[model samples]
Target: MSSKSSSQFSTFKDCLARRLISTTDLDGPEGSDDPLDEFTSYLASEVWPALPDTLYTASYESLSSDTVLQEMASDPFYISLDAIPIPTSFFDTLTSYTHFEDAHDCIRFLRKVLSDYLTEATAPPPVWKQTRGEKCEICERGWVRLTYHHLIPRSVHGKVLKRKWHTESMLNSVAWLCRPCHSAVHHVASNEDLARYFYTVDLLLERDDIQAWKKYASKQK
Candidate 1:
């Protein structure tokens, strides 16, 4: 890349960081301005750290971070929504040093990083340090049959996919709760509201109604 191109890339990085800090929410990043740049920047800065290893943490898996940064820095990348021709030379170079085994591996890891990053940034923290197998995650009631409540709800899944509110895998994420606690959660918010804003258990637990439900239902039945 020429000096001018390098400068332009740096400017894009700065602009994106500022946009992220000031913007209260991200809706439909697929349609966001400069998404290609934002994605590239995320890989370079966030994914490349190679820290937060999944070996010891159930949290986000940081792939070989340095390799990702080095790959992009050596030769830039831009993904196009429309089909575009690429030089054979670009592939030859990208293939030579890529840490991934193949194109499939590359895509899988990249997608995982992007999706997990969004969830971690906005979703509320975990309510418990550890979960009990038979207990309702909310009211901590054992002996009652626990039902898995889709935190985002299945009814709004179509909206979630269309709006890009969350990655598809996250739709299956659930919170274990007794039937009473599960019913109370739905009363706290509409399915759409939960899908967009309170898709995480911690976020649901933040609500006044949910907090009160824990107390009221702990002794019920």
Candidate 2:
């Protein structure tokens, strides 16, 4: 029993850590950088153990009932479910609670805090400046048909595992394109190919050459 307890605690910590590091800003000024570390550390040491049985029950209930989550499900960029790790059982339990408003509040807190935790681990900051390209990255199609896409597909890199910070730097390259061009790009590219497409964007951005990007997209088209 003691061994099982220890293992569960360890799993929680790892989950907590992964959640934190994925979203927090590690590069900001002292206060601006991931602000939740202290709270999370405290929770690890004291709070999580002390949390009432009911809150846990309510939490699981709230997650299950959240209709808004489906919007995320619809995204083409979304990946596997484990990235965020909200168990189906927990969601079911969350939906069954009577104090649902309170449960909703708690769930929100956990989601926000955990997301922040994850950001701190995997990303640099909370927001990023958009860099615009005049042509589609997939087709040499010009700005009129261009829109930005995640070179690595944000859904794959961490959509299942959403980090506020990843949203900032991960989309470093924006291929300007119209809707049809964007659809065509995805239709033709394999998952692996899409991953490479982002890598190419990173390479071009590193060199600060838009013309090179245009040439690459032209070839892709």
Candidate 3:
């Protein structure tokens, strides 16, 4: 790539990073919705519009064959979205393509790969034990037929844990709790909030609503 092209790419990356960080900062303690989803939407709506026309002509073959993208997809890392490296060859191939379909395919591939990587990098560790019939961890309800609750909601974190960590069960990343306690958690917070703040039995219990629910649920038979 020419020096000018490299500089443009660098500038784009910087801009993207700034946007992502700003978005993340906006996530208050009460918890926002799925951050990864928000990020992806930003790329599609905001970043795509600002990119050079060449980026819109990129081919699937080029994207699929990009070594860096493949490696990142297989062994994903947790980094600011803007810091992700795009290869010069990938850009070159994109610039050579004439069909919009090619570009669309490349974009889809990139979104899937990046989403998978981010999901894996941010996912919580899974629980391994199969401790059944235990006291509920949250409500301390004895003999209540406990169910495993993912401290981080599974919809947001489970994909990564399953893909990268080979986590196949709620036991891989959960606290044993009764049905009411488990349901109460989802009722109060979003997946992003659970992943960021309530990703532990103690933390979940610390929530005023959760605490109130625990007190109420514990009184049941």
Candidate 4:
């Protein structure tokens, strides 16, 4: 990349960082900004690191980390639309290095991160006392048996042909939500709000600070 190109790329990165810090959501108008130029420029400048070229086959726990999440939240360049902050650089790195040719892989990656984090902390559900007869984590209801909900929507992975869960894909992700609460969180929160909540949860889970997490979650609701 020429100096001019490098400068432009830096500008995009700065703008994206600003957006991550300031924007509440990504959609319609805000989501359509050109990231291709930024990504190509980054690659050319060799600012981006080499990706893991093989499929990320590690278990979910191996890739997820509360520390990574805290870093993202504190980096001033993250807006959570899902549990993971979406950025062109992330996807580009995936495609460039790992076996992330589809949406399924991406979604799987998201799941791995969140699930692993929860496992590491053994953090109880946000409403553990309310759980009865196997309450679903996502829904916060006692009626149905619980299944994991990916904070990042699976729909985004529609393009993957034969998707499977792999470690790289799931790293720095979240799981353990019942279906309803999961839906409420994903569907209701704006991107920026989602990012904030994810960060809040990381902090709360790490410190076992349920009260603080509750305060933030309640405010979002």
Query: Best-fitting candidate, measured by TM-score?
Result: 1
Every candidate's lDDT: 0.56, 0.43, 0.53, 0.39
How many clashing pairs per prediction, in order? 0, 32, 5, 21
In model 2, the runs with Cα more than 4 Å from the true position are 1-129, 159-168, 171-173, 196-198, 201-221
2 versus 4: better TM-score goes to: 2
Q: Model 1 over residues 76-157: C-alpha lDDT tens digits?
A: 3322202333333323322443444554444444334334333333233344323336799789889899888888788999
Cα lDDT tens digits, model 3, 118-217, are: 3333333333455444698877889788777765565766654654332333324678878888788888998767766677688887889988998898
Query: Looking at model 3, which ten-residue stretch has the lowest summed lDDT?
Result: 91-100
Of 2 and 3, the candidate ahead on TM-score is 3
Candidate 4 residue lDDT tens string, 99-182? 567655644554444333223323223442233345543333455545554433344333221333322243224455544445
lDDT of 3 at 64: 55
Report the C-alpha displacement of residue 160, candidate 3, in angstroms.
7.6
Which ranges in model 1 have alpha carbons more than 4 Å from their true place? 1-132
TM-score of each: 0.44, 0.26, 0.37, 0.23
- TM-score of model 1 relative to the true fold? 0.44
Tell me the lDDT of candidate 2. 0.43
